[model samples]
Target: MILHGYWRSGASYRVRIGLGLKGLAYQTAALDLRKGEQKAPAFLAINPQGMTPALQQGETVLTQSPAILEWLEETHPEPPLLPKDAQDRAQVRAMAALIGCDIHPLNNLRVLTALRQEFGADQATVDAWAGRWITPGFDALEVLVARHGAGWSFGDRPGLADCYLIPQLYSARRFNLALTPWPRLLAVEAAAQAHPAFQAAHPDRQPDADG
Candidate 1:
């Protein structure tokens, strides 16, 4: 497997965590998003969307972080990411979606760049834009964590939600989003960060992490 990704991409971070959790061995191809390499014709041939995290397992190419995560869970079920019960599975997936769908899309690199370049927004303005949308998302997440979290986001065992939530929280802190109010989230992140898999997958530990 060849995992093509950007070091700071939260979606790629999620995939890295999944791979690490499963103890999967794969090579990495770092695409320099800052250099507009993702948009180049060479990369476009692999992923027409010119997106990071295009996983190539033999000839089968996978795109979209959520889809790739689900596929990984299906293929490697030992250290399961999802819950056993049907309703619990839905709950875990819903929480993942809350971050992957609701929050992440708004703060993606393209969106930030568009806000800065096309909309005449500055760096402070872009950070403000991410903070504005994420606060409500984090508020709702805080409520859910306070209600459902048992050690981790879904339960004592790390579930699908934790995989998504931890990385998003990392991104939240990266963008200077206040997390003091979300104690449950902070606790969960602390615990997740302790795990070797999650620790190994952090942005700072990635091959492309800048000094």
Candidate 2:
């Protein structure tokens, strides 16, 4: 398998964690987002959406992190990325969605770029825009984590929510948001820091990160 992604992309980071947790050995194909490599003709041929985190396996190419993660869970069921109970699975999916759906879309690179190009948003304004969405989403996640988290986001094991939450927390820090308000989420982050899968998947550890 080949994973095509940018080093700092949160969506790509989520997919990396999923691949690691599944113990999948895949080659990295780094797309330089800063250079608009994702929008280039070659990448658009792989994914017309012109997005990162597109997974290629033989003849099949997969786009979208959520779908990729779901495929990983479905194909590699050992060390399951979800709880056995249906209700527990739903709860974990909800945690993943809160970040993937509610928070990430607003603060994603495209939106931030649009804010700058279309609305004259400076760095300070961009930071403020990120914080506006991040703070509230984190507030809700803090409560949800307190209720459901054991050691990881939804349980004692690192699962679906951890894959989503860790990347979002990384993005939160990148945006210069103080994480003091979410101790539960912080504890999960601490748990992730010690976990090998997450350690391997960190954005800074990526092959292209230095460039």
Q: Which candidate is the best by lDDT?
A: 2
Worst 10 residues of 1 by lDDT: 154-163
Model 2: per-residue lDDT, tens digit, 20-111? 99999999999988889999998899999999889999878999999999999999998899999999999999989999999999998889
How do the residues 25-99 of candidate 1 rate in per-residue lDDT, one tens digit apiece?
888899989899999998898899999889997778899889998999998997898888998888889888989
Clashing pairs in 2: none
The CA lDDT of each predicted structure is 0.88, 0.92
Candidate 2 segments whose C-alpha is farther than 4 A from its true place: none
List, in order, the clash count of every candidate structure: 0, 0
| True-structure Cα RMSD, model 2 | 0.9
Error of 1 at 176 (Å): 1.4
Per-model TM-score, in order, reads 0.96, 0.98
